[model samples]
Target: MKFLRKASGLLIAGLILSACGQQQAENQTPAAANGDTVGLAISTQNNPFFVTLKDGAQAEADKLGLKLVVVDANDDSGKQAAGVDDLLQQNIKVLLINPTDSEAVAASVKRANEAGVPVISIDRSVQGAEVVSHVASDNVAGGKMAAEFIVSKLPSGGEMVELEGIPGSSAARERGEGFHQVMDAQQNIKIVAKQPADFDRTKGLTVMENILQSHPNVKAVFAHNDEMALGAVKALEAAQKNDVIVVGFDATDDAQAAVKAGKMAATIAQKPAEIGQIGVDTAQKVIAGETVESSIPVELELIQQ
Candidate 1:
């Protein structure tokens, strides 16, 4: 009887140990199953620029042996908020966001902050929240470059039309500011018409066409991005106004090809891929509890035929 009782006790002990081991395995983090996961929220993928940015981020994440979850906001602020919320449920270790609207994205940034998830802003900034880092090209300087290029083409000053990006975006505000800084200095150059095209190709075409009806004498055009610039080119071609010098930002593949083909006067090359890569790298640093700078600027260049 004593031997049987002792045997039963050992069996119960073994069962308890086995159950504890199974529970431990079940409670293991997802990172243990794969790797640390990072979330990326892009403003939109309609344009090739943002697509390249996403690709860059994904490649870097893969190289670092990390998992990346990408979400496209489609330029909708509410959608971006919901996307962020969804990513939060995935146990992401970090977040990299390219905001659709700088101010509107603040709410989502705040949520990430509250959840103790560090955020790294890419290409655009969040106005009301604290971000561990910001990675982007010098948009203000690029804007100044674009304006100067247009002035050089026109020389003695000519009426120009400006196709702006989405309202309330840092890219639009900074670029517009830089462009005006140059234009304000040169009394000979005047902006005949300026309107927001929301950084979209279709809107750029429609807006440029509308502006043309009012200011047919416009000598040059400056678009906040390549998408808009390409659209402007379409409008110019449709109107047979091929002589108008068009300057664009983001020397995307199409834009570079356009410049090489002499369809565009010039384009400011903002290495969007590099920006995306840096954003992910910075997020890793933040996750590892390493100190990082508040802002990191990517290089920019001017491309001409």
Candidate 2:
């Protein structure tokens, strides 16, 4: 009888341990199973434009009750590839990339493709990868607008300089192409010196300073993005070339303020926040297995003083 009582107590303890183990297992559900999660890989958050883009995406994701994981590459393509790999390992339902360099980002995008994680490009397109949708402004048209403004300001066809963005970037290539399409046709207009500043303000200042040494009489300047434009403005200010018409893209707050202060001639507003919001919305549709546009264009406008 005592032996039977010992067995009963042992059986109860074993049953209790089994129940606790099952409860612990249930509590340790995967993060993805807790909620729908998506990943956003940005080229760089150091820039105000990309910061706003990230903010926009986060806001929308929060409203939809989704987990939005973000990673910043700091403008390094290799880091972006590694970041994408990390996101893929996290069981992300979708991946959004704002590539630092379009070509270099392809390997990362292809890896996402192989993992069956759909990719949606934001603000910039990726090369050699399949994407469910591309969310961005019409950069080519924005470039054309900048060129037209420069032409209007320099109706007599004067020498000007261009500060290009990062080399091998779709934004740089397309914007430069659009600018040339308009400026090259104007026989009176001349691009005296064009150089890449990698879309950085400090580099823009340095490059503009160097260009001034050779083309001091340049009547106008167009920078691919606002940071470079602001940099060029600083360089021109130091040289006291205040009358030079300087135009820029990505009408960031600083650039807009500069325009209002009469420091910059104009800027093309690409509505980065809208781009980010649309990107998340598109991701939702893609997740729902719904058909969406292959390319989604956000609005663009010219901001002038």
Candidate 3:
């Protein structure tokens, strides 16, 4: 009778141990039954644009009870690939990539697709990959808008310098291209100077300072991003060239304030908050195995304040 009792206790203890192990495994991930944990890796968090994207994706992950892993690539293509590899090893169910380079990041994206993790690209499109969705502003359209604003402000045409972002970036190329397409139609306006600032504030300032020396009659300046715009504005102010009209993209907080204060002429407002919100919403849909569309173009407003 005692031997029977001992056997019963051992069997019960074994059952209890097994149950505890199962619970631990479940706690380690966002999986529920057959559902899997989700992950989101982006190119860089150095820019506020990317920071907003991360926030939006995280909010959605919380609502759906899915694990969202965010890794910053630091604008390095190599680091971004490693981030994807790490996420895959973690058994991530979905991948949202904001690639450092459109074409260069294709190999890693292909690997993620092979791993069966659906990839949703945000901000910039990935070249040479089958992305589930691509979310970003229509940069070419935004560029055209900037040109129209310039024409309206300077009807008689004015000599201006262009502050471009990273030369090869799609945002920089398309926006700059659109600017010239409209300008090409107008024989009055002229591009006196152009230089690459690499989407950085300090570089923008230095480049503008140098351009001002060669083109002292500069009447207008267009920066591809707000950070660069802010930098160019400072240079203009220091040179006491307040009469030089300045326009910027990205509608960053400082740029908006500058517009309201009349220091800035206008800004192309990219709805970062909306972009972020949609990134999260789409990520959830992807995890649910529902198809989503690419070229998610958010609205852009010309803030003339």
Residues 1-305, candidate 3: write the lDDT tens digits: 99999999999999999999988776643333354576667767777766777787777666556667888888787898898899889988777787777787789889999988888787777888898888888888888998888888888887988899875566788889888888779888899988998777888899999999899888888889887888899899999998778888988788889989888898898877677668767777766667788768888899986
Candidate 2 least-lDDT 10 residues: 25-34
lDDT of 2 by residue, 32-134 (tens): 2356789999999889999999999998887666699999999998899899999999999999999999999999989899999999999989888889899
Clashing residue pairs, candidate 2? none
RMSD of each: 7.5, 7.6, 6.2
Clash totals, every prediction? 0, 0, 0
lDDT value, candidate 3, whole model:
0.81
Q: Residues 1-305, candidate 1, lDDT per residue (tens digit)? A: 99999999999999999999999777754444457899999999998999999999988888766789999999999999999999998999999999999999999999998998999999998899989889999899999999888887887788999999999999999999999989889888888899999999999999999999999988899999999999999999999999899999999999999998888999999988899899888877776678999999999999987
Better of 2 and 3 by TM-score: 2
